[model samples]
Target chain A: EAGVTQSPTHLIKTRGQQATLRCSPISGHTSVYWYQQALGLGLQFLLWYDEGEERNRGNFPPRFSGRQFPNYSSELNVNALELEDSALYLCASSLYRTKVAETQYFGPGTRLLVL
Target chain B: GIQVEQSPPDLILQEGANSTLRCNFSDSVNNLQWFHQNPWGQLINLFYIPSGTKQNGRLSATTVATERYSLLYISSSQTTDSGVYFCAVEQDFGNEKLTFGTGTRLTIIP
Candidate 1:
């Protein structure tokens, strides 16, 4: 089975620009999650989507938002990117309701460098 | 918000050594997992142990949910094991959200 996959392994954006990162969940998986790993902030939860609907979001500002597609794939959008927005954006997926598949499988991650 | 703390924020060990990393959460959780972020930054799921103990290869993890803490062990460590290890948890059953800890940086010298 293919693990979670993310696109644009590396991205470069300038201040005030918008960046979009993509993720494809494992087959049959219905939930996707997004996280940001900054230099000192550690890994902070960004958003959570399930079955095409955003279920929860973290403490990030309104500039950070995302949506899940019908296929369970996800996109994280960071608008008006600031220098501090630079970080490794990670995507993960899991089976919606299962005992063994509850654990999330992560992608290689996208390294976003906001200038 | 639940707070997760990892011990020995930084560690250095020679290859073939055994080491233990600890994770403590401030509250109850429905699930707990361990992940290894390689030098290249790929988050690899190491364990999905919410309770009891589970082992994979020379790596094993035990989560004492009742105590709100978990331990990850690396035996016969290799240079490939050099990376940041993270502990994540779900606040409720069927919850897809995860809060991550600060992480433990491990460096193994060959």
Candidate 2:
């Protein structure tokens, strides 16, 4: 089976601009998760969507928002971006919400560079 | 919020050697996962072992949920294993959000 896939491998935007990243989960997966890996900040959870509902979110600001489609694909939107927003945005997917122990496969991630 | 701490923030080993990385959580967790961030910055899931033990190729992970800790072992480490290894846990009482540790940076010399 194909793994999680992300679009626009690299993006360059300026502060105050908006950026949108896309993710297509595995064919049979139902849970989509977004994470941000900023340099020196480590990997931080951004959002988690299961069955088309926003189940949980990280401590990030409202500017960092995303949604999952019926097909289980997800999109993360960053509005009024700041330089600190520059990082590798990753998307992961699992079979379903059966349990939290299920493995979450990840994508190559989209590197967003805000100037 | 749960606190996750990884030991030996950085390690360097020669190729063909073995290594062990540790992760400790402040609270009990229902989910524990190990990931390898490659040089290209891709987060590759190594294991989702909430309890018991699991192994894949040269990598093996064991999580003692009751003890609130997990361990990752790499046998015969290779140059490809040079990267940052992170342990993420989801607290049983939380919203299922993963709390990630600072990670252990591993470097393997040829």
Candidate 3:
């Protein structure tokens, strides 16, 4: 089975512009999560979607938002981007609701660069 | 929120050697995962051990949930093991999201 897939491996945008990242989870998976990994800063949780509902969001600003589709794929939107927003955006999926515990599988990540 | 820390920050080893990495979390967790981020930036799931012990080939992991710590052991390490090892956890005993550690950078010499 395919693990997880992401689109637009690399993106370059300027400040105040808008950017969107996409992710398709592994087949038969329900939960989709987004994270940001900056150069110095550690990986920070961005958003979590389950069964097409926004379950939880991190401490990021309102500009960082995302939604999950019926097929369990997700899209992360970053509006009014800033230089600090440049990072590797990763998406992970898990066999969450179907199993007792979850083992998240990650994608190759989309490198977002804001100038 | 839960905080995860990894040490010794970095490690350098020779081929055919062994190494151990540690991860400590601030609070209790029900979902603990160990991943290896390759040089090309792909996060590969290494283990999904929340508690107890598990072994896979030359790699093994042990998590003492009560103590809030986990150990990853790589025996007879190879050059392919050179990369960053990360430890992530899910809080509230749920699997919606994960908080990641800073990670340990391991380099193996030939």
Candidate 4:
């Protein structure tokens, strides 16, 4: 089975602009999660989507939002991007309803550089 | 919110050596995961061990939920093991968001 896939391996956007990163979950997976890894920092949770609904979110601002499609693919949108927004955006997928201990497979991630 | 702490913030080892990394949480957690971030910035899942011990080749992990701690062991380490190892945990209730530790940065020399 194919692993989680993300588009735009590298992106460069100017400050105040908007950026959209995409992720495709593995086959048969129903939950998609978004995380941000700022340089020299640990991964921070951003959002969680399951069965086409937003199940939970982190302490991120409203400007950091995203949605999951019918096919379980997801899109993370960062509005009013700031230079501090430069980081690697990761997407992970897992089977819904499984035990919380189930491992989440991650994608290669999209590297966003806000100029 | 649960607090996750990782020990030995930094470590350096020669190739073929062995090492152990630890993570301690302040409260009970419903989930515990280990991830390795390579130089290219990919978060690779190493294990999702809430309890018990599991091994995958040279990498292995053990989570003693009752003790609120987990351990990751690397045996006969290789240059490919050089990176940052992160331990993340999710509480048993509420929003169930994953809280990450500061991570242990490891460098392996040839």
Clashes of each: 0, 0, 0, 0
Model 1, residue B70: distance off in Å is: 0.7
Report the lDDT tens digits of candidate 3 across residue range A1-115: 8989999899999999999999999999898989999999888888988899888888899999989999999999999999999999999987766336688899999999999
Q: For candidate 3, write residues B1-110 as lDDT tens digits.
A: 68899997999999999999999999988789999999878899999999999999999999999999999999999999999999988876454678899999999999
- lDDT tens readout by residue for model 1, B6-86: 998999999999999999999988889999998889999899988999999999999998999999999999999999999
What are the per-residue Cα lDDT tens digits for candidate 4 across A1-115?
Answer: 8999999999999999999999999999988999998977678889999889999998889999999999999999999999999999999998766444446788999999999
TM-scores across all candidates? 0.96, 0.95, 0.96, 0.95
Q: Assess the local accuracy of residue B73 in candidate 2 as a C-alpha lDDT between 0 and 100.
A: 98
Q: Largest lDDT belongs to which candidate?
A: 3
The lowest-lDDT stretch of 10 consecutive residues in candidate 1 chain B is B90-99
C-alpha lDDT of residue B83 in model 1? 93
lDDT of candidate 2 over B1-110, digit per residue (tens): 78999988999999999999999999878888899999888888899898999999999999888888999999999999999999998775326567799999999999
Off by over 4 Å in 4: A98-100, B93-96
Error of 3 at A66 (Å): 1.2
The 10-residue segment of model 4 chain B with minimum total lDDT is B90-99
Show the colliding residue pairs in model 1: none
Per-residue CA lDDT of model 2 for A1-115, tens digit only, reads 8999999999999999999999999999888999999998988999999899998998899999989998889999999999999999999888655443567788999999999
| Candidate 1 stretches greater than 4 Å from native | A98-101
